[model samples]
Target: MDDDGLFTIGALARRTGLTVKTIRFYSDTGIVPSTDRSPAGYRLYDINALARLDLVRTLRDLGLELAVIRQVLDREISVPEVAAAHADALEVQIRTLRLRRAVLRAVAKRGSTPREMNLMHKLAKLSDEERRRLVSDFIDDAFGGLEANPEFVAMMRSAMPDLPDDPEPEQVDAWVELAELTQDPDFRAAVRRMAEYQASERAQGDTTGLHHDLTEAVRDRVGHALASGIAPDAAEAVPIVNDLTARYARTFNRTDDEDLRDWLLTRLEIANDPRAERYWHLLAVINAWPAPPSLAPVFAWLTEALRAGTSSRPTTV
Candidate 1:
C-alpha cells in the first residue's frame, strides 16, 4: 500500500466512512489502534483497524453501550449473546410503548379531562401487583359478608381481568371501561346487595329460591312491558307482574296469594337495579364466565308498573 505498508488515517476514515475526528477518537480510546505511524507522525492503519471500526459502528447502532462494544470488539463475548440480551430488553420496551399508546387512545375516545387522563395513565402504567389489587378490591366489595361458597369464592379470586401482556385494542378498551365501572361507589353498593341475597339464602340452603329461574319469564314478559311503556303499577302491567309473582310463589312450595305477590314484588324491586345488571355482565366478561340473564327490563317494567296503574293490584297487606 503505502511506503510504510499502512494506510493513512485519512484513508482509513474514507474506507470506514467515518469522520477523521471519530476515527482519531477511536484510536485514542484504543478501539481501533493504528498499526504504525508514518515518519510524519500521521496515524496509520492496515485492514485490521478498518474492520474493527466497522464492528464498532454496527454494535453502536444495535444499542450496545460503549463498554459492551469494547468487550465485544475485544472478543470477550460472542455477538449472539449480546444480540439475544438486547432483543429481550427491546421486547419489554416495545410492550410498554404499546400499552401507553393504547392508553392514549382510550383517553382520546373518552375525551378524558386532565385529572382523569392522569388517573388513566396511572392505571395503564400499573405493575402486575397494582392491577391485581384493583380487581381484588372489586371482588372484595362484591363478596364481602357473603357465605363462602367455595366454588364462588374460587371463581371470583381466580377470575382476573387478565389483559395479555400484549393486549389487543378491544381488550384494552374493555379493561379501561372495567376499571371505571368498578371504581363507582354506587356500582359497588349494588353488587354488594346482590351478593347479600346469594349468600343469605344459599347459606341457609334455600335451593329453591332461584329454582324456577324466573329470569327468562321476567326478561320475556317485563321486557315487553318496558317496550310498551306500561308503568310498573299499570293495569297493562297486571299480567306481567302476576307472572313473576306466580313464578316466585311457586319457588316457596306454597300456592299464590295477594300477600305473596306483594312480597315478591318488594324483593324484585330491591334486587333489580340497572347498574347491577351491567356490573354482572362486565364481571362475566372479566371472568370469562357465561353471561347470566339480563334483568334490566324486568326492573324497568316493575318500576313503570308501580308508577302507572293498579286496577288489578296484588294487595300488599
Candidate 2:
C-alpha cells in the first residue's frame, strides 16, 4: 500500500491474485480504472478500484461477458437481476449440452452411419413443439376427417413423444426410430388402413368405444395360454378360444358363431401389424412411460386359434 492509500498495479495483482496484465486490461477497459498515476507514470489503484477488480475477476469466472460485467460495475443493472438472467441462460445451455451428450451417446451405441447420425442429431435438435407436430401430422394423415374410434384416436393424440432434457441413449434411439416410422409412407398407409377399417365399422353402426375390458380379457387369457405352452391349434386352446370369443361376442353384441369368429379374425389381422405395436413401444420409450406389454404374441395366438377353429368347421357346399 502507498502512503496515499493507493497501490501500484503490481501490488494490486499480488493482493488480488490476478496478474498485472489482467488488472491492466481491466483498467484499460474502464472496468477498474486506475485511481491515480505514480510520479513515474505507473498506474496506481485505490481500495475502491481494488474491489472493482475483484468483482470483475469473480464475474468473469462465472462466465459473465465483459459487457455485462461492465454494466454491473456501472450499476446499469443490479447484480441480482443479472445473476437471475444469467442463471436462466445457463439452464438453457445446460439442457442443450445434455441433449448433445445423449445424441453422441446414441450415435456411439448404434454405430450409426453418417447419414443416420445426421438424422438423429436433427431429430434431437427439434424443439418440443416441433417434435409434437411431427407426430400430430402423422395422426392427422391417418385419422383426420375419418370417424375412427374416437377413444383410440384420442389416446394416440395424447400419447406423444416427449423427450426429456437429459434423455437416455435408448430414449434418443426411440425418438429417432419414431420420427422415421411416422414419416414412412408405408407405415402411414398401414395406419390409414386401420383408420379406414374403424371408420367402416362406425358406418356399420358399431358405435362401441375402445373395449378395454375385452382387450384385457384377451391379453389375460392368451398370456396364460402362452405361459402354459398351449399351442393355438391344440385342443386345449378350444376352451380358451371359446371363452374369449364368448366375451368378445358379448362386448360387440354379436353371436358366438362361425361368422363372429371370421369377423374377429379379420379384426385381429388388421390390428396385428408389428409396426403398429412398435409405434406404441417407441412412444412409451420416448415419453418414459411404463413399457407396455408386447401384444404381438397375444394377438398372434388369438388369430391362429380363430383360424384353426374356422378350418375345423365343415364347409357349406
Candidate 3:
C-alpha cells in the first residue's frame, strides 16, 4: 500500500482511524507487530497488522482488558469464549446499576434524609438469601412460639415479601418501609398480641375466627353494600347486617344473639388495624402479588350497623 508493500504507522493510523501513538504502543507491546523498517527506521505494517489493530480496537470498545484482547488476537483462546465471559460480567454490572437507579429514584420521590438514604442503599444491596432471611426472622419474631395456629402461621409465611433482582421504584420504597416496620417494637408487639389472641381462640375450639368462611361472606356482601352507598346506620342496612350475622352464626353453629354479635364486632375491630393492612400491602408490592381488596370499609359499616341495630331495641322499664 505504501512505497514497498508496507504501510507506515501514520498511514495505518489514517486507514484504521487510530492514532499513531496508539498503533506504536500496540506494536511495542507486540500485540500488532511492524512487518518492516523503512530506510528512516520508521515502523511499517502489512495488511495482517491492519486487521489485528482493528480487532484490538473492537475488543477495547467492548470493555475487554488489553491483556485479554492480546490473548484473543494470539488465538490462545477463542473470541467467543472471551466475549461470553465478558457478557456475564456485564450482566452483573447492569443489575447493580439498575438497582442503584431504583434506590435513587425512591430517595428522590421521598426526599429522604441522609440516614434514610444510607439505609435504603444497604437494603437494596442485600443478596436474595439475605433478604429472605431478614423477612423470615421478622415473621418468626412477630408470630413465633405463641403456639400460633398452624394455618395462621402458614398464611403469614406465604405472605412473606421478597425483592426481585430488578425492582421498580415503588417496590424499593415498599421494601424499605417493610424493613423498618419489621424493626419496630410496637409493630412486632401488636402482631404478636393478635397472634396470641388467635391461638387462644383456636384452643377454645370456637373456630369462629375471621379466617373461617365468614371472611369471604362478609367481604362479598358488605363490599357490595358499601359500594351501593348504604349508610351503616340506615334502615336499609338491617337486612345486610342480618344476613351477615346469620352466616357467621351458622359457621360457628350458634344463634345470632346479642352476645355473639358483640364478640364478632370486637374481632372485626382488631382485624381492621391499619398496620396489619400496611403489612399485607407491602408484601403485595415486594412480591408483585395481587392486592386483596380493603376490608376496612366493610368492617366499619358492619360495626356501625351492629351498634345501631342494638340501640334501636325498646327499653323495658
Candidate 4:
C-alpha cells in the first residue's frame, strides 16, 4: 500500500479483474473517483473507491444503466431500491421476449405470409382483457336478439378463449385463427343460425334432454352401426335407426312418426355443423382446455341414415 493507503489504477484493475481502461472510464465519469494521485500522475483509488467500482461492475453485469448505478453510488437511492426497480424492469422484458418468441414460432410453423404474420403478431400481443372483450363482442353480435337462454350465454362466456401469459406456439396460432374466425361473416352467420335454432327449441320447452338423448343414441348405437359397415339403406340398419328414433321421440315427448322423424332430421342437420365444432376446438386450444371428441361424425352418419330410412318408408295413401 502507498503511504496514503491507496492503490494505483493498475493495482485496482488487477484486484477487480477489470481492464485499466474500464476503471479509468469509471473514474473519469466520477463514478469511482480516485482518492489521490501518485507522483508519476497515475490515478490512485482507496478501499471505498474499490467497493464502489465493484458494485458498479456487478450492476452493469445485471443490465442496469450507468445512470441508475450512479444513483446507487451517490446514495440518491439505496442499492436494494435500485435493485428492486431493475428486477421489475427485467420481468417486463422477459414477458416481452416470451411473447415475441411465441409469435415467431407461430410464424415459422404456419409459414405465414407477411399479411398473416402481421395479423398474428397483433392477435398474440393483445392484453387478456382486450382478447376477452374481442371474443365477447363477437358472441354478443352472433347471439344477441336471439332467445338464447341465459344459461347458454353464461356458458359461452365462461368458455371465452384466454391466451396464457407465456403462450406456446400452438396457442398463438390458435389465437390467430380464432380471431379471424370470430370476425368472419360466414362463421358469424352459422353461429347465429345455431343460436336461433337453440332459442326456438328452448321456447318449446325443449330442455337439454333432447340433445343429450340424441347424442347418446347416435354415439352409442348409430356409431356402432357405422363402424359395422352397415349401409344407411340396408335392411340390417333398420333396428339401429328405429332404436335411435324411438329414444329421440321419447326425449321430445313425441311419437316415432314421419313428421317427428322429419323434425329430428332438421335438428340433426343443424347439430352436425362442422364450423360450429371448429369454433369450440379453436377456443379450447387458445384456452389450454382439453378438446372434447367431435360429435359431428356421429351426427352426420345419423343424418344420412335418417334421410334414407325416412325416404324409403311407405307413405300412407
Candidate 5:
C-alpha cells in the first residue's frame, strides 16, 4: 500500500490472486480504472478498484461476457437481474447439452449408422410442441373425418411422446423409433384401415366405445391359457374360448355362436398388428408410463383359438 492508501497494479494482483497482465488489462479497459499513478507512473488502484476487479473476476468465472460484466460494474444493470437472465440462458444450454448426451448415448447403444444417428439427433432435438405436432399429424391422417371410436382417438391424442430434458438412452431410442413409426407409409395405411373399420362399425349402429372390459377379459383368459402351456388349438382352449366369446357376445349385443366367433376373430386380426403394439410400447417408454401388458400374445392366442373353433378365414381389411 502506498502512502495514499492506494495499491500498485502488482500489489493488486497479489492481493486479488489475479495475474498482473489480467489486472493491467482490466485497468486499461477502464473496467477497474486505475485510481492514481505512482512517481514512476505505475498504475495504482485503491480499495474500490480492488473490489471492482474481484467482482469482474467472479462474474467472468460464471461465464458472463465482459460487456455484461461492465454493465454490472457501471451500475447500468443490477447483479441480480444479470444473474437471472444468465440463469435462464444457462437452462436452455443445459437442456440442449442433455439432449445431445442422450442422442450420443443412444447412438452408442444402438451402434447406429451415420444416417440413423443424424435422424435420431434431428428427431430428439424437436421442441415439445413440435413433437406433439408430429403425433397429432399422424392421428389426423389416420382418423380424420372418420367416426373412429372417440375414446380410442382421445387416448391416442393424449398419449404423446414427451421427451424429458435429461432423457435416458432408452427414451431417446423410443422417441426416434416412434417418430419413424408414425411416418412409415405402411404403418399409417394400417392404422387408417383400423380407423375405417371402426367407422364402418359405428355406421352400422355399433355405438360401442373402447371395450376395455372386453379387452381385459380376453387378456386374462388367454393369459391364463398361455401360462398353462395350452395351445390355442388344444381342447383345453375350447372352454376358455367359449368363455371369452360369451363375454364379447354380451358386450357387443351379439349371440355367442359361430358367427360371433368369426366376427370376434376378424376384430382381433385387425387390432393385433405387431406394429400397433410397438407404437404403444414406445409411447410408454418415452413418457415413463407403466408398460401395458403385451396384448400381442394374448390377442394371438385368441385369434388362433377362434380360428380353430370357427369356420372363418382371416379377413383382410
Candidate 6:
C-alpha cells in the first residue's frame, strides 16, 4: 500500500484528493470499480483507480459533464479531446454574454420603453441567415433594375452589411445601430432617395466621372466651409453651391450645364439625412468595410444655405 497499487477506498480518496462521499458516488455509478473486498467485505481499489479518479476529479472541475467524464474514463475520448470540445463550448458561452452586454447597452442608451426593448431584442438576435436576408432585401430595393450594370451592382452590393459569426463589441454595437436604422422611417426615405438617384444616374447613361475630381472638390469646398463655421444660409453659400456644381460637371467630363447642375443639387438635397450618414458608419463596423468620408453634412450645409440668404456662396470648380 505504501508505494505499490491497491488500497482501501478511503486510502484511494486520500491519494486522489477526492472526498469520500464523492468517491462513493463514482463507485456506485460504476465510474471507478472496487478491486475486491477483504474477509470483512471492506471495499478495496487497484492502484490504477487512483490515477483514473484523479483525472475524473480534474475533468469535473473543468466543467466536463458526467456523461463526458465517463467517456474520458472509458477511453472513448482522450483528455485533450474533451478539453478542446469544452473550450469551444466556452467560446459560444462568451459570445452569448457579449450579445447580452450589447443589448443592455442599447437599452440604457435609448431609454427603451417595453415595446422598444422587445423590438431591440428581436433585431439583436437575428441569425446570420436572417441578417443576410435583411441586407439582401435592402440591396434588391436599391439595385433591382440596375444589377445589369456591373459597376453599379458591385458598389451597391459591396455596401452590404454582414455581421461576423463571432462579432466584437463594436461590431455588435454597429449591428444594433444598423438594425435601428433599417426600421427608421427617415432613414428609409433617405435611402430610397439614394436608390432612386442611382437609378436615375443609370438612366442618364453613366453619371460616373472617369475622375473623382468633382466629388473630391465638392467634399473639399464643403469641408472648408464647415471648418470655417460657415452657416449654410450666408451669402457665401451661393458660391459654394456654384463651385460644387461646376466640380460635378467637370467630374462627369463636361462643362457646367445649368439643368444638370440643378438636377444634381436637388438630388443631393433629397438624399441628405444625418441618420443616413450614421447607417454607413454602422455598416462599416458590421462588415469591416473601409471608412468613407461623410457627404451628408456637406449637403446639410448646402440645404441650410439654400434655405437662407445669409450663408456664403458655394465654391465652384
Worst 10 residues of 4 by lDDT: 308-317
What clash pairs does model 5 have?
A: none
lDDT for each residue of candidate 6 in 31-54, tens digit (9 for 90 to 100): 987777767887778867877788
Instruction: State the local distance difference test value for candidate 2.
Output: 0.89
Over 1-317, each residue of candidate 1 has an lDDT whose tens digit, in order, gives 58756888888877878899988888899888989877888888987777888999998888888888888888898899899999999888988998888778877877879987787677766777777799899888788767734465576687667655665544566666778888888888776776787676576554553334667777777777677777675666677766566565666533535565455555666567776566557656544568887766566666556445442433331
Model 5, 21-83: lDDT tens digits are 998888888899999888898888889998889899999999999999999999999999999
- Regions of model 5 farther than 4 Å from truth: 256-259, 309-317
Stretch of 10 with least lDDT, candidate 1: 308-317
> Clashing residue pairs, candidate 4?
none
RMSD of each: 4.3, 2.8, 4.1, 3.3, 3.4, 4.1
Q: Local error of candidate 1 at 197, Å? A: 3.0
Each model's TM-score? 0.78, 0.92, 0.82, 0.86, 0.92, 0.79
Ranking by TM-score: 2, 5, 4, 3, 6, 1
Across residues 196-235, which tens digit of lDDT does each residue of candidate 4 receive? 8889988987766235556776788867877899877788
RMSD of 1: 4.3
Off by over 4 Å in 2: 256-258, 309-317
For candidate 2, the C-alpha RMSD (Å) to the true structure equals: 2.8
> lDDT by residue for model 3 over 99-172, one digit each (tens)?
99999999999999999999999988888778778878988997777766677677877776677778999999
lDDT per residue for candidate 2 within 3-63, as digits (tens), equals: 9999999899999999989888888888899999999999999999988888988999999
Q: What is the lDDT of candidate 3?
A: 0.81
Candidate ranking (lDDT, best to worst): 2, 5, 4, 3, 1, 6
User: Model 6: residues >4 Å from true position, as ranges?
Assistant: 1-5, 105-130, 147-153, 159-171, 207-211, 252-261, 285-293, 307-317
